[model samples]
Target: MIYLDSAATSLQKPPAVARACSYAISHYASPGRGGHKPAMDAAAAAFACREAAARLFQVPKPEQVVFTNNATHGLNIAIKALVRPGGTVVISGYEHNAVTRPLHAIPDVTVRVAAGQLFRPEETVEAFRKALTPEVTAAVFTHVSNVFGMILPIQELARLCRERGVPFILDASQSAGCLPVHLEELGAAFIAMPGHKGLYGPQGTGLLLCGQTPPPLLEGGTGSESIRQEMPDFLPDRLEAGTHNIAGVAGLLEGLRFVEKQGVQSIGSHERALTVQMGEALAQLPGVEVFRSKDPSQQAGVLSFRVSGMDCEELGEALGRRDIALRSGLHCAPLAHRTAGTLETGTVRASVSAFNVPQEIPRFVRELRQILSEKP
Candidate 1:
């Protein structure tokens, strides 16, 4: 199948990722709990994965990186750790429901929303500057919107937040491995990302990287201190609780290795080139209208559009019948669609991968044109 849902989750991960996971399962052992060889081996593997993630994300200390089940859990930890009750939080309109719902659930939290599609670097900086009252403790936004692949000016916003002493948090599920991120350069306090997405790892793997000073989200057994009932107030052990996703972590480590070898810019350029080709082709097709960031520099690997006179669901199904996989509806970013003027019916989202080739774009566009011309 010609899979076009990489933004949702990448398929056909690097061979090393699968191999690492299989090794984890076959040579099973509990990490940080046992003294045997198997346990030691498992622990070593887990630590290596953490170190790899830390190195990739540019965290100073390996222990500062906390592994979560997925980006949702990581986001929850980030929101809970920084956003106290009765504090103001600013979130972009482009955030995923993973971020928006969690912020909404925080009692006494006041959310100030801004335009998702129209947000440029300068506007984002201004928003942070205007919202940095003493009462505003934190701000959350996405580096890239999963809906239309719009890339926000995160570094500029991060700098603004740094100056104002407001903790800047990023939900980077769509941009993690697809874009370059150095924790030091961005100056963000918290970053939540799914390892499965651009990281090319298996599902159920995710991580949260925090600045030099980060709050603890959960208190539990760290295996280092079984004697303490309360959680330790330090680094990853302070946040990561219970058994970890060892298999998934194994896969993620290999994924990082693959990315490191291939280079992030290369992956990003490849994905963008493919998306641009697809978007241009789609725009040229009859009865098709594409929704994308006008500026190519401000977009990611995803593209959303609609065919005139066809429901989104029908178009997605039609595309699927032709061996193409695409996502329809809100894409967990209703606010983004609202900003893009596509919320009422949603749009058909085609998210390309670094692995997608040049030939696939023309084929996808030709099939789309054919499908749109047919009667429902």
Candidate 2:
């Protein structure tokens, strides 16, 4: 099977990740739950994973990194803490439901989309600058579009938010391990990411790096200050409640090690090369419409496209029957589909990963062409 949907979850993980998880399951215990040897070892293992995450993302403090169930869990905590009632929050047009739905749930919160033409970062920054009014309490931006893989100018947007004294929250779900993310350099109030995507960890593992401590999303045992009725005011313990996912974090540590050794720049270059090759081939095929950045440099590994005569679901099903894994439909980002003019007929998305090879692109294109050639 050829897996092409790394954006949803990385199906190809390093062998070390699996090994680490297996080892943890048998030997590790719940972190911070007890003072015994297994519990202490588990706590230490979790802390080491936190440190690894902090180093990879350039987070200033290790404790500032809090683990969550997934990117959505982390995003919810950041949004709920930063966005003020009746205040405006500026976001990119390409944000997933993870960002949009949370904002919608907030009472009296005004959402202003900084709409930008696909692959045009300058226009995106300009639109955001114009929308930064005094009434804006916070600004949230996705580092890259999951649908189109168009990279947003996050540094410029961060600077603009700083100038306006608005707290900057970054959704790095698609960009975390795929691109270089310097938390200190970006100066974002919060950055959320999933361990299962670019990080190559198992599902149900995520991290939220805090520039400033936010209020705890849940109140419960943090394995610290058990007697106190209030949640601890410390860094990670304040946000991380309940038992830790020791096995998941153990796998995440190995994944982080693999990424650090391979380097993000190298991984990104490889993925983008595959995307370019696949996108170019698809564009040349009859009746195929590719949705991506015109400039190859402005895109990541994700490519969205559609065949003229076929529905996206039909095409996806055809490809699936041949053991090709990709995503179809709106991709949980309707705003992105609207921006790309694919709202009515959702596009098929093929996102590459480091494990994917150049040879796979031609095979995929050939299969897609054959599928499209068939009469409905």
Best by lDDT: 2
Cα lDDT tens digits for candidate 2, 222-341 = 889999999999999999888889999999999998999999999999999999898888989988888877788889989999888688998899999988999999999999988778
Inter-residue clash pairs, candidate 2: none
Q: Tens digits of per-residue lDDT for model 1 on 19-81?
A: 999999988577888899888888898888889888888988888788888999888888887
Q: What TM-score quantifies how close candidate 2 is to the native fold?
A: 0.99
- How close is every model to the real structure, measured as TM-score? 0.96, 0.99
How well does model 1 score by local distance difference test? 0.83
RMSD (CA, angstroms), candidate 1: 1.6
> lDDT of each model, Cα atoms only?
0.83, 0.92
The Cα error of candidate 2 at residue 324, in Å, is: 0.9
